[model samples]
Target: MTTQIKMTEPQMLQQLLKQGFEHLNQGQIREAADCCQRAIHIKPDLVPAHFLVGLVALEGQDRKTAFQAFNSVTTLQKNHPAAWAQIAKLCMSDGQINLADNALKQALKYPNKDPMVHDLLGTVLSKMGEHKNARKCFQEAVTLQPNHPPYMLNYANNLIYQGELEESESVLEDIIRIQPNSPQAHWSFSGAQKATNTKHIETMQSLVSEKNIHPRSLPFYFYAMGKEYEDLQEWDKAFESFSKGAKARRETVEFDEAHEVATFKHIEDTFTKEWFEQDQKGHSSDAPIFVLGQPRTGTTLVERIITSHSQVHSAGELQQFGLAIRRLSNHQDPRRFSPQLFTEALKLDPQKIGGLYLQTTEKLSGGKPRFVDKLPQNYLMIPLILKALPNAKIVHLTRNPMDACFASYKQLFADAYLHSYDQAEMARHHARYRHLMDVWRERFPGQFFDISYEATTSDLEPNARALIDFLELPWEDTCLHFHEQKTAVSTASSIQVREPAHTRSIGRWKHYEQQLSTMMSTLHEQGVPIDN
Candidate 1:
């Protein structure tokens, strides 16, 4: 008779883990969790089992359980690379950036061979505004997996943000070669450089002409084609590509107009002038300088001007203030900014909220006396910001409504500006934003400094002087030389901001007046003025 053997507990545990991982990959969360839990029960300190559990929890959006499971994995096996990477991701999302940085440092102590771990680690660092460090991690990932287009793309995108355009273009070229049909690679490659000829345009056109192109990728190809046409001065072809791209992209995301309406109404209804005047104490710090307004309205340009000062450092697009308010309010709504969340945020103590925000944001400040938090969407949080940091300086960048709307509509963002893909929705949102800002100006006269993009770009010196004066800082010649600064810009305006101030982008919407009738008519109906 042939010898028969029953599998040992350790071997059985390995089999369970394999099944768990397969189920996780298949999106069978409960099945994966059951397998992991069984493995854990058999060997309570099984690190891989716990790590798998953490991954499943993350997929299910149970961050608490995910953190616990990851912590368990780290406890069982210190210097576990993937566990630390996931932990750092959670910490970063919670606005505990210093903790995330610490976690990353721990992860880097060991040799991590996994490309995904490096990519995850790099993304957290990117969100923390440590773009240089993030670039290193992305490079490591790219080196580990040269054939993977996503890995190479991550490296290239960071290169662009860091203003390494030549390298970005080379890397993108490689990505295109590796995957000849990648829509994203084409889009990114088009953005990284201005078109000199129609050669690459014809290449992208061939790929997009394939009837089998996926719906999810249609936007990228179309946007790339649109940009090339725009550069070539073929306005009609550009608009056609832009509209088709926008329509395809719009189908993939969700945006509720009613939610935005209520959220704007809630802010105006609650944060009255009298409420701000109330002696409800807030964190007393004068280190924050907020550069905010609608996206594509010169917010980044102004932030660059402000941070060109020796005393100011740029903290790119912080989520801390909103996270602080949300955490302290004890409301666990999933949406970033919502009517429910905003209403609940009113219950928070300004002092506590402000204290948490500064504490989390402290690590991003580069020993500067003041720091610029250049988040355009922060215009929505102006009332809270003033209440929380009374001495904070707010600069609102204004642009012609049509120009601003058109600019956003043309560009493809990475996960934000949801309404930009639809002309009517984009116009209505802009109108609402303008109305709320007017209310804020009336409620808190002289609380903020407003500068128009047109005026600032046309008369750089006087506007720059006034801006410097608003912050009570002595004027410096450096503010006028922002384009020459060595700081890496991580926004849509990255490439353009590298050049001296110019009014070339002004009245750009006029080029598309025929194509943008829906947007202009919507703005008119909403009573939003087209002029700055």
Candidate 2:
């Protein structure tokens, strides 16, 4: 009777867990959390509840809370494969590849571990630059779950990375056949098509015209249309399509003042002279390459060109340096900047920060000789990077100020870059970026390379060769064929990257001159040269 009663309790716990999962699936996060917490309280050994809570916390962007929750799960089930895999994902997100690798190794010890474990391990291996091993893991995951969308997408992406365009296209086509209405599948197909330089405009046009298409499909449609027009050298049509796409992105003004205040405080707090001194103390190999300039000033294009070099890889946009500065200045109240706080920020672990950056790049580049970290906003942090890694090379991409400002104002960024919405704010930000770059040039002359977008477009091959020489890379013909390079570019300029290099982007602001007089006046007041 006692044995039977104990078995009944196990079934009851399983039923409760199912109920919690149902709540989770219904978008009731708080309710799901409550149910999971209750289940865990009832059965301290319930690993799933703990995992659910951790996942919920992570979804809420509460990393500390999520970590604590996952830590509890691991403590209770030391050898649990799922718990280890969860921890590995968290570590990967935190840029702790080594820890994630170890966690994944532990997870593979379990018999018949989830396919996601293999997928995640593959991602971590990819991040660590272990491409061969990552490919094996992805292959294993696909074999284990042949129809999984994520596994298919990731494996296809890997093939794209390896320049296997036909194979990637086939895989994406399979995805489209299986899930014809999937916006992401179409987007990936477009990317593969762009890479192969095959005409895909008609396919995209058909998708756009489908009744009841996904809202998320709009951006890609307009982006694809823009690319199509650009390929045909229809500059006005391309600009219009891009404008429509940017506007279609939904905008909300909640917490506008708070956001502005926080950003202003962050800028004031992090860019102090004292903060600069603190970041200078420790550095090692000077292999840092910065791709910086105004957003839409062709920084991404520059990155794509440089990264095409055999020795160079892309690190995407790194927020860590800025995050490090902000962390160091955390002792200061946001209400105002203090000299004392500035002095304390000066005492931060520059060596530690530099070490963290090196650690991150080492993983991302997979032992490539050089890598490009092209975060346009990094223009503001160039002084700190130079101080920390004096051997680092900075490439500053310059566009006509009006063109840059107009481009920025007309595009929509994800929530993080809120300043671009208003033309005046966009102009001000561009001026500030220019001023800062000038200051950096004065302070560290030979450390920087200034490339004009006009020069690059007017004479693509020569400028590209010069850039290669500047980076000390053996010239590759492929660098000159950058537009034909098919990699996943997650930026507003994705459409532009698909086409060959051209000078049509120049003087684009003139068409909207009447719409941009305020921005022009602001630029004039700031002494920015706009006539060109």
Tens digits of per-residue lDDT, candidate 1, 392-510, equal 89999989999999999998887788989999999999999999999999999999999999999999999999999999998899999999887778888988899999999999889
Per-model TM-score on C-alpha atoms: 0.94, 0.76
Cα displacement (Å) at residue 157, model 1: 1.3
Model 1 lDDT, residue 413, Cα: 83
Off by over 4 Å in 2: 1-7, 108-113, 125-143, 146-151, 155-163, 173-181, 191-241, 250-284, 304-316, 323-345, 368-370, 402-416, 420-425, 460-527
Task: Report lDDT (Cα) of residue 16, candidate 1.
Answer: 99
Clashing pairs in 2: 129-366
RMSD versus native structure for model 2? 5.6
In candidate 1, which residue pairs clash? none
**What is each predicted model's overall lDDT from 0 to 1?**
0.90, 0.70
State the lDDT at 354 in candidate 1: 81
Worst 10 residues of 2 by lDDT: 332-341
Clash counts for all predictions: 0, 1
